[model samples]
Target: MEKSRGMLPRLFFFVSRPVRGTRGPARSTHVGAAGAFMSGGAGKRTAGPGRQGSRSALASVRAGAARVELERDDEMNCETRDSGVVAAGRAMTVLLDPGTGGAEANYPTRPITLVLGAAPGSGADILARALLPDIAAEVGQRLAIDYQPGASGNIGAARVARARPDGHTVLLSTRSASLHKVMYPYMDYDFARDLKPIAMVATMPIVVVMGNHVAANDMLDAMELARFNPGRYVCASVGVGTTNHVLCEILQASAGMRMQHIPYQSSAAALNDVVAGLVDFLFTPLSAALPHIKSRRVCAVAVTSQLRIDEIPDVPTIEEIGFSEAGADDWYALMAPTGTAPRIVARLNRALNAVLANRDVRQRLARLGYMAPG
Candidate 1:
């Protein structure tokens, strides 16, 4: 005699029956049964096959319960937590499919809102626009990007933090995610505390440019400009607490270099002063400094990255010049307020990665100084 695999479903169904002197009809069917199944009456049972069916029935019930418990939280994936088998029916894959909630096919029910902390003309805002188009297409809903600039994005971040947990709203910001705790220690909500990590965005490198006349003849020469000159050297930055400010502080603390930290109202003002040698040094991103470097207005002394930057291969890195740790830069990434459904996160990750794969989107982002990808 041979056993039929078709009988497995029957066996699984029979296993759910109780064997304690239980009796019931064999055929049972229910419509729209996702986890719970239709079964015959529970009555008298025998000690042989009836007992086995009853045990299998109990196993099925436990399986469904375990599946729900494993993926309903902030953990990475189903495999990490629930010892639950990796299958569509049992596992939770958020951000991978918009119509994941028991739909016949993954489809989004509403538009998604991506909130950014930068101003309208800022680099972050531009990057958001560049990335949003393709992603919005994939998810089948128009993406509405809302920029909330005050408090460096605290206002908009707070909005998402309090939004519904159904994954409609997202937060996009730079490395400031981690520093937000430090930047606004007294704020009502903390970044990492209130938001969940989605995916890391591209990293923008900062360049170390210098004036022609101030070329450090030697290490002693550079140190002289840093230490001996002291307050005579004024450092200009687009604003306080940006990568520029961090780099300026690192240099001051590491080499005993002292300079006046002047916060500019805008990047243009700081660039102009640096070009005219009105400011001793200015810390800016490659995108902002590229124009000055090409126009012979500013010199790129070194790139902040640990290696030589491809855009400006002629420039050296800070580490190469015996400065072991005086480099600082910014990296951007996607985040959602805590408690957003994991399924939604997985869906968004898939959509965003698909958009990034497009050749035109990739090239345009590179042109924007994101270095291809981070």
Candidate 2:
């Protein structure tokens, strides 16, 4: 129920587009000559030929309102009135005027791209899709959900980080996004530097489930089994450096046990292997592992939340098993590239708060074992 506070300004690259063939009063200014300045507008005409004859030329320069547009064809591009600016043979540009006002006034001139860092049907993906309708309705803009799954969500996150900070492209990510820096030191982008946290969406407890082949009935039993026969048991996680993987590591450290770590690319694959007894146990989202537990395909050991969840009240928590420090919750949040405009971030935070405040949205999220932010 905690809310995000304050607003942080993001970086923006301004591109000046002059009206073609429209001449106005001449204005002189001293600045760097880099890109092609088209004819027209209120600016002093530089000594350059018209657009038809020259391959590259500097047009009149003026300090006017800044506009940003998204280029869908390429991953991302930064356009500035500096060196090496190419105006010819470029994609269509949709101008975003930041000086207009708040996000409600001048944002989302186009469809917003909601990037999911996980595979389809995964917990993160499901949550992102579920919240789309309500968010789109509140924002008056359709959200285009894009899936970029790989490297435990780093690939998708990287794309968002490199995207234009026009609030059109944002990412819906989990805690795993923050853990990537420590896990993968050679990564191209830094999560904290490239991605800005907008607002928290929901939080859920991770359930510990064991296959039928395991004799452990509870977390205590699982710890004992691992202690007695070290390395005989293996735990499966959605991927390396994920929340579930970290939870397993916490459990191992807290319980003084050793087990082989098995990482899978997707939750479905990890769950399937766990059900087949190929992997002894798994710590996964309740929504993904609940059906298996109910069908008797996997034994519920314990949840990683500090308190028992309503969806599976019978499943004890890690704190209840005398390992309070091992408790961890899986959380999802809205994020944009660090350079996104402040008004856009504020607008997104407001819209998300409105959607989360909806009674029906809360009920739907609760049914999926997710706790909506207050």
Candidate 3:
């Protein structure tokens, strides 16, 4: 596997939040102002005019960090952005404590913990593992990976949101982290209100795959077979309301067909079931399914990206197959607790971009079927 290298270009930064009715990958919006100054009173200061200095300090720190990230981005020539994946220019949110102005010089006083919302061998996990050694070298500390997978990423996200707002602890999350609010409304933490976006990671397309035993040659054939036997085929997803599950729903809605939906706790488990023929087909991330597809354990029916992936050249895209609504990509990101100091956020962002700039890292991510900006 070490010899396997991707032929795709490089990936940069694009941090974005999900919006209603938006198509393609999510877009980045500046949340610096909202996070820069503490929000208690609306446009009014309750603690007299002394708070003005703190606000000003926050602004200065944010500006400095943004400049650093910009310089690093320019050094890497990070102009090429992939539409299928989220990329960003300025990836840090500004939130600073007036007293911690010089503390960033000594950031990551201890080992850092990168929390993953999915199980091992998942796309996000693969990304984190690939980047950890370089990131640890940049931050001058050992990086530890803590997996807290469950509840469609809500479990791990909530844990990160509640962690101390220090650089030592951060979350490496995916699109599912953004969707938990709507899927599990009764959750403990509010993702948008609690966590801060640090930097954009890699993005890969979702794929429609089937076991070898299935009688379908391609996506169109699979859909036709399902149409002939409605509700006879089973579709699998990591969990209900996950990006993959949503893709399953979209495929069915756009194709005007039905398949039994099976939800699992992890992408590996769901995909394993698909390979074992327990489940008929599945909508999964390319990172998880790539090895299986290469091994011929399962057949890729279609991809949910706007373009075809080099890893699987023969597989048709959902758009070409007339299921445009089902075409979408998944992204990974670095995030921290909301109150983390702006300088720390900026430091991490710089480290993340630096890692992405590495040729080996980019190639490894590409092998996972992630698209590079053209």
Top candidate on TM-score is 3
189-255 in candidate 2: lDDT tens per residue? 8876677766667777788888888887677777788766655677777776676765665556445
Error of 3 at 263 (Å): 0.9
Alpha-carbon error at 123 in model 3, in Å?
Answer: 1.3
| lDDT by residue (tens digit), candidate 1, 1-374 | 01111100101111111112111122211111112211223223223223344345344554653121112222222112111112213322222333443222444678888887655545566667877778789888888888776554567777777777666788776543344444555878765457765654555667766655566743335546656554555666545555555555544444555556665544556677777777656776666677777787877777666567666777876656555345544556677777766566666665666676677877777776663331
Report how far residue 132 has shifted in candidate 1, in Å: 2.7
Q: In order, how many clashes per candidate?
A: 26, 3, 5
Q: How close is candidate 1 to the true structure, as a TM-score?
A: 0.64
Model 1 C-alpha lDDT versus the unseen true structure:
0.54
Q: Which residue pairs collide, candidate 3?
A: 13-87, 13-88, 14-87, 14-88, 95-342
Q: If both were scored by TM-score, which would come out higher, candidate 1 or candidate 3? A: 3
Worst 10 residues of 1 by lDDT: 4-13
lDDT of 3 by residue, 1-374 (tens): 12112221121111122212211122312112111211111222132222344345334544543111111122121222211111223332222233433337678889999998889887778778878999899778999999998777888899998999987889987766665554565888877678876666766788888988789888778877866665567777776556677667545544545566766777789778777778888888898889999999999989877688888989988777765545667766678887887778767766777777788778877887774221
Candidate 3 RMSD to the real structure: 15.7
Report RMSD for candidate 1: 25.2
